[model samples]
Target: MSQPTDSSAWPPPAPRTPRHARRRKLRRAALTLVAAMAPWLAGSWGASRSSTCTPRTAHADPSFWEQVTQEPEEAARLERYQAEMQRGHQQASLVLGEGRQRDVEPLPPLQRRQLTQEARRAFQRAARIRPTVAEPHYYLAVFTFFALHSCAQCQFDPAIATEIVEELEAFEALSPLDPRLTSLLGDRAILYTRLSGHATPAKTREYLERAIADYRAIIARSAGLRQRWELTYGNLAEALMMIGDLEEAIATYRLAQRHASTASILLGLAVAMDRDERGVEARTLIRELGPDAVASWEEDVLRGDTFYVPQGEVHYYRALIAETRGDINGAIAAYRQFEQSNAHPQFAPRAAANRAALTRAVTRAVR
Candidate 1:
């Protein structure tokens, strides 16, 4: 899978919908015990990919809901329908809470699949009962996408993809002005981007471009939510980087930096600047971050804290900054620190190569 840059900088993520709130709560609850877990463990033990996912409810109970609930006294039926929808939301939240336990105690494949299926069933019921509301559809899309990767044995379901688009289209029609709609759009963008992981290059570019467009739209209308704006820009920069648009990525990260103060954004900007050969600029930002600040943030991450830049990535960026400034020893040391302290499988090889090349250079210089 193509890895996207880490985007976990904003703490206390913006308020979420009921289902998402529950999911976030799971992470927060796990944070207290995160220090006890392996430093490399992700915040969530994402769904297991070994098994196939089966929707808990094969199909909505057309008769039980449509006839018994809706066909009863019309006035009472509406009230009952609303109640059912609320119940559905609650059900989904309950399943999500269980899934979140993966942060504390890793879930087995069967349990993960069951939780996702149950959540989907609840959300599906809500969507059926309240066709106009966006929450059910939003959660459905999220859960489906998440399960798609987790259930590696499952075949891609075109129907689910179609459902997500149709639901999002309906949501936009229902609430054009609701601010939460922006988040939904961003979610859709991410969905497409994730799909592009196993897609053709053209498709990958197309999805990433779509994600960028959604992010840009949010930025255009972002009025009050500084946190959302920061996140959107960071996401946009990440998409840009995926497509090798280094210059734009650098520019977008700079924009994100102004909106939020976090090591992740700074590191993002530093990485982009380095890629674009703006090493001096990268060094400046890294220096501003300083060693102490990076250490504190890493400590938080090690303790299973949520909403901070990742633990070991800082060292990688610092090494790059040192290399740009011709500080061979500093660069080598930072690279070593990263290797010793963090198990970032993706960056480890590159770090080793950089270190080896620098060591060779130093040996020649001495000769």
Candidate 2:
């Protein structure tokens, strides 16, 4: 059967729409938890393959007419399926306190689990009824992700992460032309990146590579949407840097700068350039941002008020800047601060090495 093209019939509206207001509440809840766990977990970007049916070809499909000729039984079945999906969605939203002004009073553990399971079962049944439709899968993914995130006892598990990714992929496959596809991709990419933080070195690289791909795809899909491009490019650059692709990371940060030279982008660009041996350019960028701006950015990150920048990365960059300026004590101090923050497991050892090297140089000079 041909998939329905009607927005109302499948995929639903974007999160900003009144019909999807619950999404905003879910986002707030998820982000609140994310802020406590990791500062870099928020923000959105994405891209996907175009559907085979072009606008011109859509009108010529024979099955398009068949949709209008559905028998009463089939029509009734579809209505029931939609109702089931909506019921699940609404149940999940209420459990999460979708539009309530006050925060949801914390539910007892047993009651919470029961309500969450009930909502999950409803969405699962809806998916079984209409496997080709994307809406059920989309909600399932969202509900699962946020539910786990909001659960105080739930640790970040790779198995659950994989399941969420599969659900998102199903939605993407079924709704390639949907406007929300990019946002979904972006969320999946962020999930991968977060998973990488707790993975082994080999697995870390694999996750970062996947994240980089998704961010690039988002950049491509965003096109003239300058803000989206800017944010995605910044994210892509950070992923590249994580995987030690300094040259590409530098280039990506520059591309992001063209769209909007936000402080986070500039800081990323400076760090990438400094690492790539473009110290002069990197220092110049820092000067443009100034010490006050860097301090402000760092404060926001430490306070968990910022997105798209990892915590403590600013201290690492500051150490580099201090070292370049021949301030051994200041450089060592900054490196120690970076270490104390315990951020970026991949870079912590490097910060220690640099600090040790500076210590050795200072001792030799004293001799």
Candidate 3:
């Protein structure tokens, strides 16, 4: 699925000692980062397009879709509308270009808002013209979901949220048996489960349950999508973990591993193991990643022009695990190494701060 460009792994900052104050800071940072990440519905828009894909904007005309409607054949009109939708999705990535970094400035609020509105309108018009087409509805749902986090200070609006779900439901109804429906459901599951933390307990449970069902559904329909199966399986485990079903989460990750073993899946397995109190397994998994394996994953992701790498957080978690086991020196080393090597500014600062705090605490205790 095509979508707006945004940040990756917008997790809360790693907590520091003095648990109460750190928890408050974590909550605030989490909310802010959620907006920062933009919560776009999918990965790189370019990656979503097949080699035969052509952009509507190759001619640089805003009236392209309007012109397309004049085509006599409904199939031709639908093709043009779909191309317009792709342009809209690509324009979003073009507007935001790469992602916001500490050194790079993002688009101005006014320009961003206008461009985002344009994209939304493009997606909207596509759905309006081809009311029966599932693709348009899927893009509309993506745009709506992304819009919820497109701006800073954006809060969860129940109305807008409901609209997203409705659009997804409509898409599912149109393409009940389409394999692509699995992708749309996975997007819905991810969006809802991620936001559930800030929502009510009942709401949280509802979303987690929905996500679990969708993920399972994808697994059950594994036709020719081994890759999607692994991805969805990991997500199911994450949803389970969010709801404190750690045992199931662990089992699911293991199940995913049996099908395909990638760094992203390995990270999920490691995190689940650590959270499930299997520190030894988590540590071994991290060690198995090694430097070469980590580097290769990074290179592969960069080659694909995707910025988000699940392996990036490996060393950060490694430091936390070391610290939890009371190896302050080991934790300090790991944190510093992570801060120096990682590109994500958000996590680097957290790692640096933790490293400094640990260093100070160790020094004070020695005295």
- RMSD (Å) of each candidate, 1 decimal: 21.6, 18.9, 23.9
Supply the global lDDT for candidate 2. 0.69
Tens-place lDDT digits, model 2, residues 5-28: 111122343233244344444565
Worst 10 residues of 1 by lDDT: 5-14
- Model 1 stretches astray by more than 4 angstroms: 1-87, 93-119, 122-136, 142-170, 173-179, 185-200, 224-228, 297-360
For each candidate, give its TM-score against the true structure: 0.51, 0.65, 0.47
Compare the candidates by TM-score and give the number of the best one.
2
Q: List the residue pairs that clash in candidate 3.
A: none
Question: Which candidate number maximizes lDDT?
Answer: 2
Cα lDDT of all candidates, in order? Answer: 0.60, 0.69, 0.62
Model 3 is weakest, by summed lDDT over 10 consecutive residues, at 8-17
Model 3: per-residue lDDT, tens digit, 223-289? 6754556666766776776566878888988887887776656766776676565757876886776
Ranking by lDDT: 2, 3, 1
Inter-residue clash pairs, candidate 2: 46-218
* Predicted structure 3: lDDT: 0.62
Which is superior by lDDT, 1 or 3? 3
